[model samples]
Target: MNFFQNLALKYSHTMMQKALNNNLKVELLKEPQAKIAKEKSYMLYAHIPFCHTFCPYCSFHKYYYDENLAKNYFESLREELKIIKNKGFDFNAMYVGGGTTLIDEEELLKTLELCKKLFNIKEISCESDPNHIDPKKLSMFKGLIDRLSCGIQSFDDETLKKVARYHKFGSSEVLQEKISKALGILPIFSIDLIFNLPTQSKEQLLNDLRIAKKLSPQQITTYPLMKSNLTKDNIAKSLGVSFKDNEFEFYQIICEFFKDYTQNNAWSFSLEKNKLNDEYVSSHHEYLGVGSGAFSFLDGELLINAFNLNTYTTLIKEKQNANIAKAHFSQKERLKYVFLTEIFSGSIELTHFNHTLKCDLEKELFIELKALKICGAIYKEGDILRASKFGKYLFMVLMKDFYTGMDLVRAVFRDDARLKNKDFIDIMREDVDPLNAQNMEFKA
Candidate 1:
């Protein structure tokens, strides 16, 4: 790495560590309250932690699919939503994410139905794998889902095989057929691609992008692989993978190839106007998360649910909120988060920040904002601070650092939850030592 690039990476890493540490001193709440009174606009995120098969590179919380267990989990999920509703928090948009949220079609449909009935849901987006998108499922989701994102990590057969996704999802031709069928029914069809795999070359990444372009989906999200302790070993053993520093080159290729398309964020691009995209971080300042291992940002606090499925269901059944840990943010910390998310979404609106926070950004973040401008990472345009082409990559470094920090926290909690002991809650309250924090081996 060059001097400036190394400097930016180091700075972002430090800031991310600080942010993670600040949020690590969590409190175990006996009865967590869903704070939704102050925010007039927010989205609901429901996490389904179940998948038919686990990929070696994934870090999300998920369990092996079980018919009876999934059915009961959905029932508990419904009750959790009711708890939020009873607190007078209404949601208009919902995003369902997971380890193949459509693993069990019946349970997923039931959950979606309840979400619609409970709230005035105007738009709903769901995620699935290539294997789950069939004629039967597409028919059921025609009008109910506004956007359907399929995880087609890569089209390269070798890369897919190395990641343990090839056999489970089928060949490229099968995936294409499924994509075509979904395009005929879904309002907004999107596909996700992961770049910079250990075995992935520049040619492979370009080919993947070419296939994505050929598919002509309304939206495409190309993600960098973010590995945690849980999957790093598995990935290395299964794929002989090593982290590479070629992410910037791959990102540039996408930007150049899709120059005509609108940039939704650092990773997402769209061809159609008013299409649904996964820029949830920029869209809402506060959101409530339902289901196990989901995180929530509300009233200047971050709340996390217990990662254990059994404990989650048991807590909800006992008429208690599933929240196990809470981290409150300071005003400055909140402003910094807004600033970072806004910049990542393409620009920072100074007026909006000033109006919302009732404080001048130049004053609150004088040094940091000034440094960003002086370093040519951002430039001022009227009341907005926009990211330069180079700024996008630098901000991406920050985002990758932040997300890795989050995954590290999840990894620690996931391991603790596996013990199925009451002391796990107390362990979660303690801050993660900086030296002990799991660092991302790759740029992701």
Candidate 2:
């Protein structure tokens, strides 16, 4: 990498980290949050936050799967959806993500049915794990889900075992068979792969790609190992290896390997047109997310729901809403976000940006654009600015840092949720203290 490029990326990391820390100093929301304009169309992202086993590297909010609690959670979610609809908001497209969204197949279908019935939904996307990818189960999702992205982070058996995926998802050979069976399940079938794991090697990465090529899904998303402090510490103890990134080399290999595949974004490769990747933020400028651990972005405000199951469920049931915290971003900050996302997607239309931001980009972002250009990160294509190869790599790093910051922010909110839980109305009774062992009558 050029010194200039490295310097620009470093600067961006620092700036973004600062912006994230500032923006995420959240103000706890009072009950019955204020309404906003319905001028924009939004993609709905519904989070299913229950996983059978937790992976050390993931930063998303998740809890262990509990069937009864999940049932109640879905019931609350449906009510929350109705409340949003009553607020005069509607969703165009929907994306279901999660601690394995397919854990309770029946409830999932029921929720999707309600969403479609309530809104004018054009398309729906869902995420699942390899263990849940059965033909019978997938058959039920065909009409409902346009895209199904399964998390298959690696195809190396030892790597899988290191991450504890081998026991849960399956061995690499079994995963290959499972993934092969998933082909043609939906309009777009995407499998996720993570590059540059703690102790992962170049040969292992190439091998994973080779297997991915053979499985031949409609879309494949290769992500760098994005680790937050929570995951970073856990990854060390769990994998017994440092949480490091070989981003530049691994990313180049991925981009080179997927030459025939269309670059849907910097990291997502697609075999077909009009298919969506898992990154909802890239496609939707503002999105409304429901369920525990969900985030909703409107204008410059970010609303976050409680991450705890009890808090989320109780809030939704009582208040008909689960929004627990909020943070505001300034216009400049919003523009910076747009710049990163648009450039990451390969190009930025100058006219669209100027009209939306109501500012002359050349005047406002002179230094940023100039720096990126001088660093060989972006090039001009008429009125549009496009990312050079190195720019894509920079974007990957930038986004990783951005999300890591979010995870750290979530850590704060999660703690806040625990504190705020005490003040909630009609609190669910518990025999044992979750935070303290004082209520544990079984304690010796």
Candidate 3:
């Protein structure tokens, strides 16, 4: 659809409008509350699950506003913080995400202030809708936060609508205006851009890339649209939108464009170099989770909160330990996990793999990657692994393959361990159904 045709498509009225008028005031689930540990260093994540409008591709836990409920949530959050403080925890990274973090100007400021009260935060970041940030609001955030990640997915209007984005493209201009209005109160910031939006084209993407280069956010994270049955399928159909078959090709173009902008022709993308140097990388930081559906890494375990908001609130109120469920990864699994994470960041080092892991990527993984290297996929210089000019767009998929192979290797190790235990004969005993049991014993 290129950009224009997709932009002109109207949303069909067939889709059910989500029921909006619900009194979500007061805690929906009331359980005993926990005593917060104070003065301890730990990360904090507060999820605000309300959005003015929903985007089709979004898969976050969110809901519409009930003023009273919003108020209660904030109070509950403050109480939650008190509990954390009493527990003697301190956090260096604080990220408040979703449902539009900055809806009410005054309230948002108070929330920011409250965050400061809760943690000795060094790098605090929040996600904001374009509408949430104006001159006044951006100023409020100036000293309160170290970074901002704007959900400015695309500058192409048609593509924005196809994705059900609430604001228009060039909205970054408004963001820029707000930042300018703050008069030297700019927090290091980044913008999110999605490419290969249903039926989008190379030229349209390149045009959007040029605008991104001009805006010159400290960093840019480009992602491809991931469709799911849970979101706006009708709107997607209306636009005749679909994923590109040749995704890797689209990825190469994006990588080349950005690499050139950053290196060869730095003039166009030079505006935010200083900010990039000063601010901490947003997603690259080690994070901790709070609130519903948030995941945090602690003591080599991943703790995930209940996905249901009601369940989360109930657990919080009942003071039923927030440690509801946690998954512990072994040292080998952790190494594989780190490798996967490193790949997402566009690079990894050979030295990162310690001697204990049983993965041999020297031939199957790295050699194959080099031999059949997609134009912009990866580059190897000695031990350092980095993405090439065309690799950035395809990086996510490439990383997926690495994880897939790593999983196979992990599975092999498990099989080897089981074999060493000599459980093969004993395992057959457990599965011995009358007919199969006799056959199994005969085979053995």
Candidate 4:
């Protein structure tokens, strides 16, 4: 790395560590109505934390699927939606992510039914694994969901085996058949691929992209592996390989290979015109997250739901908010977040920053913005700030560090929740004591 790149990485790591360690404060809210009402526009995110098989490289909050438990969890999800509705919050779009969201077909249908009954949901996006891709499932989702994304991390059998997903998702040909069947049925069909795996080479990634392009999906998202403390250890132990820090070459290859397609974001490419991809990151400035292990951002505050499944259901049953942690951002921190998110979307409008934050962008983020420009990471075109070829990779590095820190925080909360503290305050006091009540404002 060059001197400037090294400096940028260091600054990014320090800021992310401080935000993770000191900014996030845990607390329980009896009623989160006032907080919910503050956001003018937002989407609803529902997380299903169960899967048929858990991959060792996975870091999000999830558990092995149980039929009875999943059924109960779906019912509790409905109740949680009712709670949000009662707070006078409605949503135009809903994004359901998970540990294989379509693990239980019946329960998923019922949950979508409840969503339709309760909210004026115009656009719905649901994520699934290859195991759930079939004509029957696609037919069921025809009208209920506008977009369906299948996680086909790689079509290479060896790569799948290394990740322990081969047996669960089957071979490349099997996935191709599934994708072929669902092509025309789903309105917006997208496939997710992972690049820069421990065993992945540029040739392998190029082959994966070729296969994906042949499938002719509406959109494709290529994600670099973001490893947390636990996942890093797990991947090394299972695959006997370590991940590399620099993926600039791999990212550049993708951007160049997919030049024919429209770049929707730093990582997503689309073949369809006027289609929305990367909804969670590019759709709304803020969103409300429901379900265990979900994160929500609103009015400069980040709210995280309890990671423990039982705790999440119990809190919902008792008519209390399931959010167990929150961090309120200072105006400067909020501006930084806005800028980062805009960069992820491929550009930032200087006008939007000025109007929204009511401050001059250069005046507020002088050092960071200037350094990025001087290092050729970003460039100005009229009123817009766009990520240069190098800047895109830099943004990815920043996001990876940010998410890795968050995963570590979730690990702490997961361990503490297993102790079964009577109140969230106890968890905050015992596990997150140093950061507690320092910059925290509780709604309890």
For each candidate, what TM-score against the reference?
0.91, 0.91, 0.66, 0.89
Model 4 lowest lDDT segment of ten? 435-444
319 Cα displacement, candidate 2 (Å): 4.1
Query: Which stretches of model 1 miss by more than 4 angstroms?
Result: 1-6, 30-36, 415-434, 437-444
Error of 2 at 27 (Å): 1.1
Candidate of highest lDDT: 2
Flag the better candidate by TM-score, 2 or 3.
Answer: 2
lDDT of each residue in 1-444, candidate 4, tens digit only: 578876776776677667655665545444443445654546889999998887877887788899999999998888988888888888878899998888898899889888888888888889999988788877887789888889998989888887788888888888889898888887888999988788677788899999999999998989888776568777886666745643777888899988999888888888966445555745676788989888888888888787777888998999877887677778788778778877877888888868865778778899989988988789999999999877887887777767666665565567534545444444445445445323333333
In model 4, which residue pairs have backbone atoms overlapping below 3 Å? none
Q: How many clashing pairs per prediction, in order? A: 0, 0, 35, 0
Candidate 1 lDDT over 230-276, as tens digits, reads: 56688788777655667778878888988988888878888866535
Report every candidate's CA lDDT.
0.78, 0.80, 0.51, 0.78
lDDT of 3 at 307: 49
CA shift at 167, candidate 2, in angstroms? 1.6
